[model samples]
Target: MITPDLSGKEFKLFQDFILENSGIFLDINREDSLRISLFSRITAKGFRDYYEYYSFLRYDALGEEEFKELLSLITINETYFFRNPSHFKFLKEYILTPLISERALYGKGIKIWSAGCSTGEEPYSMAITILEVFGFYKNLNIEILATDVSLKALDKAKKGIYSLHSLKLIDEKIKNKYFVPVDKNRFKLKDKVKEIVKFEYFNLIKEPYPLIEMGGWDIIFCRNVTIYFKIESIIRVIHNFYNSLKNDGYFFIGYAETLQQISSEFLPFKWNDIFIYKKEMRDLSLEEKDVNEKETGITEKKIERKSFNKAILSRGLYSKAMKFFEQKDFSQALRKVREVLEIDPQMAEAHFLAGKIHADSHRFVEAVESCQWAIQLVPLFLAAHFFLGVVYDKMGQPQEAINEFRKVIYIDGDFGLAYFNIARIYQLQGEDEKSLKEYTNAIKIFQKSSSEKALEFSEEITSELLIQTCRQNIERIKGFINKKNE
Candidate 1:
């Protein structure tokens, strides 16, 4: 349906409405997204233009429900398990494990909150990380809370259900340990893990401070939430976060966000490639600096800035390569990735991309070499390892392929493709039961509310069609089993 364009007045109306209700400023840049979002519903409800829709949203009896529906459409919920594995790596090796171990000695408590935890992936991933580190000995007092403004999102979080896309970054071990396959494409998080996380509906901008208790939180992950707010509101929210955090409590902001021009209540601590802020001993509300604060501390400023610039260049090239790869222009894609590699040879992501490009062209030896380089630089790189497995499979080294695939599963329990390949190996070996189990696992990962799009063969073989194929194979295997017994 062709939805009408939103006039300036109508756009202003929505901007004001969103700001007044949620403290989120929908500026000129967001007009297109707002227009598209409203258009989808406006046309469905037979409204002609943005003005009519605005009036209906403001005055109609069903305006409230319509507004809720609009919120669901407009909000960004693009998240996956352990979206940034580096941060998870930091959390485990540097921050969490030590803190928990020391606190365990004294039976102290830890409080962690995932602010704006869209569909609960962040918090659930956190729970899985903790489980990986601590195992079943849950002696220490721990409280984990997940909050989001969208009631619909919170409801999904509370239900603890997710698609394989959300679990794409997760390993098969974590999936097997913490999640039960609900069907083809959907997985339900285990009750033990789900019970540890408390999901609540709370708008950061509109809600009052201390939604759970009065401060003293050891860590608060408020990443990507404040980007929607106006500068004034962002300042207020950051202040609230600072006051809410206990002394030396950790505060994590998203990569695109900075405490720079807004607040100085926290000190930025540089982790490799990322920076997390720590609450200072002295209050800085009064001693706030007017200058835009640098993201990293001043000592390593030059090195970090140089590296950041290099990363920017490499990323721009890598992005072009991905676009080329997506369009099936493998040569140009390879060229772009090579440009990235020249600028930063140590870039594991670029190497991974080059490996994918080579693999797509069926140059298995080159693909293997590129993936090996990626593994050398970033050993836990799941994509590189998975692609290496694919390369080995194509090279007719079934055992070698199986070994690499198992490594991916070991790293991320929810990697269904690894299971799918393993099942294929079992089938080749005439192990019907093992093959059926693996195929069932893969099918369970792919069955979802919607069909997933194809991934150009780099990854993600789990789609509705693939799930059906797996089922057919399972049935065929069953037939073979029955005939053999007869």
Candidate 2:
């Protein structure tokens, strides 16, 4: 009889299969979860051994259905009603208000897409946003298309049922108006809101985006969705999103995600505590064509951002200082940065570089102060944020570090280094699933920059580092599970 202890070879094959089919790029870290999920599949299929099941999946006509089920079982669908209140707040206060007010004048349709609408909460939440903003605009053609790859999830989405636990955080007024009690513990969505949203199954990696058929949506919420794929996958998906939006359409993402790595086709816009993107109209002229062609072929480049500037330092002195610092001479480096700063107090780059050195030396408090000063001088500088995040991480303040990293991506999405650090934090927090997603985001950007050298290094490191971490953790978790059984 076969058991769920997948062999190293079989596991690798299964991981590759997931990547090829779903663009989800799994590592050994997910092995325990995959084993559990896959065990259910095997047992349901009446398979005894791992090899037999593997062969069956490879040769059987039912493999595709089973594979889809595997994705459904392993995919993280931890969404709640009106989660991340800021995005919806922005939509209601800024986006929906303005769009509906404008539509009132033009008598046009309003369309939105919740691109990765897990369990239907996001789309339903968005529908509520429209209702709240427009109030009596029942005359307006307001439509929301909610899509996900899991048929099981989509099925639930269509039903629009939520447990009382999921509704606990919702405002009573919003809940009462939008959902009516169906039974002791169940609630059905009011017909008014139900008619506005249509749930459909979509694979961001495979199936054609249904948003195309729905026409140019006025807004799209694809937050935290792209953090799960390789660089090519991100590029493909982002471009598809760009194509699906109307001119000046808005895109919303998780606060932790940004379009800095994706493209400049979207312009950053901020509202009261909420951030979103507006699609910039493309210039299709020949000059624009040249730029486009250059962009199309331009590979992802390794970031070589200097956290600190050297111009403030006397060239000879700076070189000498760097040599000392490289030799682990923190005192000398600190003195050199001070000397340079005394000569040019506003030298943002120099302060940042000093912060980097301090951060590397584990002088986190000094690093934070220096980075904060550098940012004060040059707010758009990415080095300051990166250094600040590192300092926060060293101090064991992960949320602070996460905020700093989020700022880095906000200014520069293509910052593969920041993504790597963010992934590390998530991993350390026992959020391997989230870490895997972030690692994939970094990989996608590295791939796009066609940064073969850096990409090779990352692939080598993550394949060893993250894969091993996952395996070890999974083993630990399984041990605990087994002990519980006993």
Q: Candidate 1, which ten residues in sequence have the lowest lDDT sum?
A: 449-458
Clashes of each: 11, 16
What lDDT score belongs to each candidate, Candidate 1 first?
A: 0.76, 0.71
- Could you tell me the C-alpha RMSD of candidate 2 in Å? 23.9
For candidate 1, give the lDDT of residue 239.
87
Candidate 1: Cα lDDT at 437: 93
Tens-digit per-residue lDDT, 279-351, candidate 1: 7654334324212134334433344445545655676687689899989999999999999899979767678
Error of 1 at 98 (Å): 2.8
- Where is model 1 more than 4 Å wrong at Cα? 1-3, 39-67, 211-213, 283-486
- Writing each residue's lDDT as its tens digit, candidate 2 over 389-463 gives 877887999999999888877755656656777887887786756776777776666554222222232435633
Candidate topping lDDT:
1
lDDT of 2 at 450: 24
